[model samples]
Target: MFRFLRGLVLPEAACDEANNSSRYENLFKKLDVNEDGRVDIAELHAGLKALGIPLGKDAEETIFKTGDSNKDGQLDFEEFMQYLKDHEKKMKLAFKSLDKNNDGKIEASEIVQSLKILGINISEQQAEKILKSIDADGTMSVDWNEWRDHFLFNPATDIEEIIRYWKHSTVLDIGDSLTIPDEFTEEEKKSGQWWRQLLSGGVAGAVSRTGTAPLDRLKVMMQVHSSKSNKMNISSGLKQMVKEGGVRSLWRGNGVNVIKIAPETAIKFWAYEQYKKIFANEDGKIGTVERFVSGSLAGATAQTSIYPMEVLKTRLAVGKTGQYSGMFDCAKKIFKREGLKAFYKGYVPNILGIIPYAGIDLAVYEALKTAWLDHYASDSANPGVFVLLGCGTVSSTCGQLASYPLALIRTRMQAQALLEGAPQLNMVGLFQRIIANEGILGLYRGIGPNFMKVLPAVSISYVVYEKMKQNLGLA
Candidate 1:
């Protein structure tokens, strides 16, 4: 049943191993649920879930088969002890491997080195936070005993497994349209499954973006064109777009939008890793502010690298039909007509927007989660999946709301040349012109379609991601 799961294991740390049998007994009692002196599959699943180790069906079956010596579909005390002892032996081996130079301890440097081998990069300071979690003595290093005790109940078979969980995104979207990349275990990397995961995510993103392209194009149009003379509401905006171009023109800029996701995500993730090192605190820990600063800087770095594409995207979205052949042609014309500097129009406001977007996103997300916890603590300890997603969606929308004017201005600045007789304005002047001409409401033109696309984008991305995972044997 678990032909492909037999080799997958968790990382092991060493502990006293003294009174190990008794420890096993206590754990067994806990998993036994009904005090029947045995743990069946159902109880075992529940117990593992409580430990926050989500195992797949194949992994669960492999584990169950390994410990059920009598073939009874359950673990008696003796079998359970034997299984744990066997696991500990492997855990000790894992610890020995991590203790480079035969030092009998794992230091932050060692942790960093080990992860780099698995394609996960982190600075020594970032590694220290990981070390602090298991370094009970405040000695800044983990001995075998501390390692074993720290992960006694964890199902992770290797350091990579634990590290993946630690580094995984908490849905703390610090920038508009930016998501932290997914982390993968060593096994996944070695087996070439990491790329598959990335491919799936990219596919999901493409599908989501394409599905919402019409609204996106409309949003860009309204952001650039709406003023005192021309108030382009959603209804009129759609008709105007259709009048100018065919139905398919609604997706004018989508090709480049989908094409840019890969490089943008790659650059953003790489920049984030580097930024975390720079922002690392002396005390070897990262808090909300640190995270925000690191993420904001990373988002800036990524945007700077990809800003040209951003300009191209804006241009293509607002361009008349047959204005340019395609993304390449659009870029060529822009480069030829305007100097390289035009590609970076509105760079200041774009970077400025990141701070508020990230800060408010993080703050509102935390507040929402806290409120959810406060209200539902007695009923449910964990805010279920839907609640978490809801909180994330609302928090992200709030962040966009706070930063939308900046985005609107940035879009206008990019598409200024496309609009004939449109005043060439810097970020500040753009703001003044919009406010003087169309009032405060004009600053948020096209927000209706922007909000309208959010649900469909989220839903499509999620559904496609899950489907892709299953297709790639990751589910």
Candidate 2:
């Protein structure tokens, strides 16, 4: 009974010998209302109606011609079964003949060959469609697994139905119809600390740039292909940068990064809040996990959107010292030198880092805020100062720790043109070389100063953003 019920729910397929005949036999036995080898015209009509197949003009004649092999004006189970078996056999033969290699696999080239043999010479446009239908991976090659998944009907697979359901799920919250949650009252959701946030994050970034600039310069110098150092230690690398470019060259792109970060954080924080609201529960209440998840996703989205600028900034920093005047000049020079795509160099490393960096950073930020509010300012109406300090320290540390290795790879890839000339490192090759030459520790070379930079940078950023939010009352 369960098997029959399951079959009923399954989509209709081309009728086959045993199954079709068995189905018709069951209907014949029901409609005949008496034990008989044949079904009358009236009985046939009733059976067709029951099966949801319409019997219209010349229906009786058609039935006799199709099902009644003996011209007996009615179908017997044996005759019907014979017709079904013949039809099914033809389809199976066609499929087998197309499998030219007889490897039970169908590649694109084989499919094209089969089609030509059958005298259905597909046009280029038509060929593309045929390829797409069978090529599940979009690789332009149809393997046996792909053929079976797409072409062959299997009782176990409902791939199309599952995909359809996935497509239909979750409408985005858009327009005026989408209401903002009111968990924190309008008054309670006060403005952010714009100026304070700005100064703190900005100062931290400036200081970080100053502190780490020499190390960054050294790292870039060591990555230089022409540099004959088969082995470059940090000490030796630093000596090289200082000797070649002078001490001032270490802080080369500090101004550009400082300018970029303020607006970067602005977009990041704003987009994060908006995305949070979107992914958050319809209920006003959101848990720590949800907030963390939302914040991380938001951070990733923001980082991706702004990464081109980061590429430009890094290029300006590590390239020929004093060659580029500022961000705009660097942008222009990069475009002229390597094309616009160069600005998005190291996108893989940049994007991959976002997942873990954002996840850990935002999770820590929120956790710190909650802890501070609970322990330090339990009775305070506004947990502003405590939240800002906690968020700054936690977020920056998490982000730097999670992202610095990828950061190293990105730096190398970005400077490859200037440093190595022509050749560049794909993400895999760069990491492989890093591990091979310097060991795993090589990837985290500048991590010390990076951690130092993040504290003030993130702290000031959040403090400014929160102040702005408080002042604006955007909620």
Candidate 3:
């Protein structure tokens, strides 16, 4: 049996799955670090340590005791997997056995009976609240499937880790738990620091310019040709752009975009700073909730104030086919044709989206920076440049990926404003049209180029901005 299993299990590369399964499997292996076919208290402690889990021994023991089934003093791989797979469900199951009624669900009455049998303590109100949350269908009863599915496919693992880190980290009392080496010179820090800040800022600027440019182009094309009412394929649209104005046609609105980047960056960075300061302390330490609030508000403030300029930029980019004379003409035309409201066509989704985008982006970037700092421990090689690059890649990727759907909505809404006699499409209609015409992937049109362009570009921008501030004694 051992030989057969060994033969079946090739090396790590061979065991890799084709999709997201590989990620889960890798996480599982990290959790099962000992390769001992089971996880005991010692093994669990070691695994937690490897994951940077900083909980106390008592807390660790509580988690382990609840996780280990059969009271066998150790948990086998299967038991460990089961415990991880549906933690809440498994706990409830242990309670459910006490119910003595095969109702295929758990409720307040059920909880009382179940807790009684398990000799556990819980009040009626608590039981009711728990039951309601787990009910899934608002039926006041949580069936096995609902309970299992909720816990089994839980993607809140990161959130849970964040919670754990927050709790333990609070006790550490901030003061550089990680150390910087004496040999690391001030010159090196200076070189890396200012360069990284500028690079990171530039990246944010470039991505903001580039991402909105193509979509602006598309929206304009849609608007201009709305009178004709012909569907535009991604390819044909490109062809039309090139044919109408030569090779430079695709870059028609780039001038306006170039100018817009500075203000957009200023607003975004400024708002982010203000909001972060307001929500957090001087050291810029914040919990998940605070991070979310700060980020969201930052995005909202920046996007809302700069939206008119954004609209102007889009018009210029998309007016390649003689739709509008130039940025000035486009603005004048819009103001004349549709009034000032034209500039703020899709402000609702645009403003609201900033919140989550800022929150997730900042939260992820800051968290990644902290983690990298922990791992590298103030090594000279892990300069501000490296930090900016790493954080930029993560933050930009997360922000763009999460914001794609809303972006599509904003695009359609803005396009609708420019297109004469074009059928008015709500968010649902827009999604349906995209699905029918180009499939689900249509909504994520520029995600690939967005990711590729963002990482290095933003890194450099950030490096430059930070270093500039430091040199100017403004930081």
lDDT of 2 by residue, 371-458 (tens): 6544554222234554555564656466667777887787778777876445577989988887887788778765544444444544
Q: Which parts of model 2 are misplaced by more than 4 Å?
A: 1-185, 188-239, 362-399, 448-475
TM-scores of all models?
0.70, 0.48, 0.47
Give the best candidate by lDDT: 1
Q: Which candidate is the best by TM-score?
A: 1
| Residue pair clashes in candidate 1 | 9-157, 10-156, 10-157, 10-158, 11-157, 11-158, 13-148, 14-144, 14-148
Q: What is the C-alpha lDDT profile of model 1 across 308-365, one tens digit per residue? A: 8889999999999999999999999999999899899988888888877777876786
Local distance difference test values of all predictions, in order: 0.74, 0.53, 0.53
Q: Per-residue lDDT for 1-475 in model 3, tens only?
A: 1112122321223222342244334445665666766667776667655554434444455556666778887777666655555554454554356345877666677665554433333455545655554454568676665554333322223322212222211000000001000111233244353334434444445544444445445444643342224656556766777788876676677667666655654565567666756877555454546545665665567667878876786666555467887778888988998789878876676665665565566567667755654455331213255555666566656866776666656756766765567677766787787778677766665444345545444444454445545554434
RMSD of 2: 24.6
